[model samples]
Target: MTEKVIALDIGNVCIGIHPERCFGALGFRSLADIPREVLFLAGERFERGEISEAEFLDGFRRLTGSALSDAELRRAFCAIIGEPVPGMAELVSGLAGRGYRPVFFSDTSVTHMEELRRKFPAASAVPDGIYSYRVHAKKPELPMFEAFEARFGVPAFYFDDRAELIEGARKHGWNAHRFVSAEEVDKILG
Candidate 1:
C-alpha cells in the first residue's frame, strides 16, 4: 500500500518568478561579487526573522562590503533555488488526494519568506500555509520535527535531499526517502 506524502519546497521564491536556477548559476559564480558568508548570514537572519527586508539588505551590504541592491539579491536567491521539481503541484495535490497532508518545510529566514510570499501568494507559502520561519525550524532538527508533529500530526513519510533530515525523520519514526528525483517519488506512489 502506498502511503500519503507531503511536499515542502525549500526555495527563495516560487510561482511567476520568471523561471529559476539563475541565482547560484550567476550570482555565486563570481566569488568577488558575493561571498558564501554573506549569503549564509542573510539566510540565517531571514530564517529567524531577526531582520526586516531593509535590515537584511543593509546586513547583506555590510557582509559583502558590496553595493548589491534588493533586486540583485532577489536574482541571486532565485538562482540558488533552481527550478521547482516538475509537477510539484500535481505531487502535492496527489498526496492530498490520498488523504495525506502535503506540507512545505524550509529552513528559511523571515525576510526571504516574505519575498516568496510576495512572489507566490497563490502558493500560500507561509502564514495561512503549513509551516514557517515563525516556527523557527531549520529542518532535520528535533524541534522542527516535534513542531510538525504537533501541528500536522505525525507525518508518515518525509522527502528531502538532506541526510540529516532523513536521519531525523528516522529518529522520529517517519518513512523517509532521500531525494533522488521525481521518478523516485513516482515509484513510491506507485
Candidate 2:
C-alpha cells in the first residue's frame, strides 16, 4: 500500500491573511495606496529568498516612502498574518492520525513563516513542508511542483485557494482542489 500524502497551502488555506492590515499598520489608508504590481514584484522576490530581510524592508520603505524603523516595519509586515482558519489544526491532526502525511507548501517569506509557525497551531502541527523561501520558487511555477514531486512523489492531494495553483498541480499530476473550508476538506477526506 502506498503512503497517502496531503499538500496544503498556508495563506488563506491554513491561516487567514489580510494585506490591508499590514498596509494600514504602515500608515497606508488602504491597499489601494500601494501599487499592486510593484508590491507583488517585491513580495515575489522576498518570498523567493532572493532578497534579505533588511533588503526587503528597505524596498518596502522605498515603496511606501515611510520613515519607520526596522522594528516597526517587521511588526507591520507580520500584521498581515491573521488567525488560523478555524479547525484546520484539528483537521491536520486528524488526517495525520488516520495515516495521511500532511505537509505545508506555501509561497511565504522567512518573517511570515516564522510568525505562522509561532502563532498558528495548524502550521506547527505539520512539521514537514516545501516553503517558497527554502525552494526559491512559488506555486504555478514548474520548479515548485518539481520540488514537491521530488520530495514526496505524485498522486498527492493538494488544497489551495488559487485556481492557477490548482491547475499547476493538476498539470504535474497531483490531485488538487480549491479549498473552501475545513469542514469541506474534512468531508472530502474523511
Candidate 3:
C-alpha cells in the first residue's frame, strides 16, 4: 500500500499572495529596496520565531520609516494575501476522497497565519498546519522537512510555488511538484 500524503502550500498554491507586494505596500519598491541587514537578518529572525510579532513590527517600522499605526502596519503586512484559488475547496475534498490527507505546509509567521485563519475559510479547513515559526525552521532547510517527515511522514506529493522548496522536498526522497494552477493541481491529484 502506498502511504501517501498531500502537503499544500498556503501562499500562491491554494491562495494568491506576492511577498514583494507586501513589501511594496509597506512602501518599498521590492525586498531589495529594504536595507540589506533588515531584509536578511531581521527577516530570518521574524520567520524563524526568534523575534516576537511586536519586535518584528517595530523593526519593520524603523526600517521602512513608515508612520503607519500598528493596525495600519498589520494591514500593510497582511495586504499581500489575496483570495483563495478557485476550486481549492473542491480539490481538498477530492484529495481526501483519494485517501490523501491534505495538510498546510508553509513558511509563514504567526501574525500572518492568524490573520489568514480569521479571514479565509479555506485556511481553516485543513486538518493540521506545519508552519516555519512553530518549528523554528523554514523551507529549503533540511531540518524543516525532517520535522515534517517525523510528524506526517514524507509526503507522497508536496506542492509548492517555489522551486527551492520543491527541491528541498525532493532531497528528502519524496515526490514534489511546482504548483502552477488549480486545474493542474486537480488533474495531478486525480
Candidate 2 lDDT tens digits, 101-180: 88889999999999999878766568888888888988888888888878987635899999988988888778899999
Better of 1 and 3 by TM-score: 3
TM-score, prediction 2: 0.93
lDDT of 3: 0.78
Compute each candidate's TM-score over C-alphas.
0.72, 0.93, 0.87
lDDT of 3 by residue, 18-113 (tens): 677677777788777778867754458877888888988788778767788888877777877777777776676566557778888988888878
Error of 2 at 139 (Å): 0.9
| Order of quality (TM-score) | 2, 3, 1
In lDDT terms, which candidate is top? 2
Backbone clashes, candidate 1: 9
Taking all chains together, the TM-score of candidate 1 against the true structure is 0.72
**Every candidate's lDDT:** 0.58, 0.85, 0.78
* Candidate 3 residue runs with Cα over 4 Å from true position: 1-3
How far residue 14's Cα lies from its native spot in candidate 1, in Å, is: 9.4
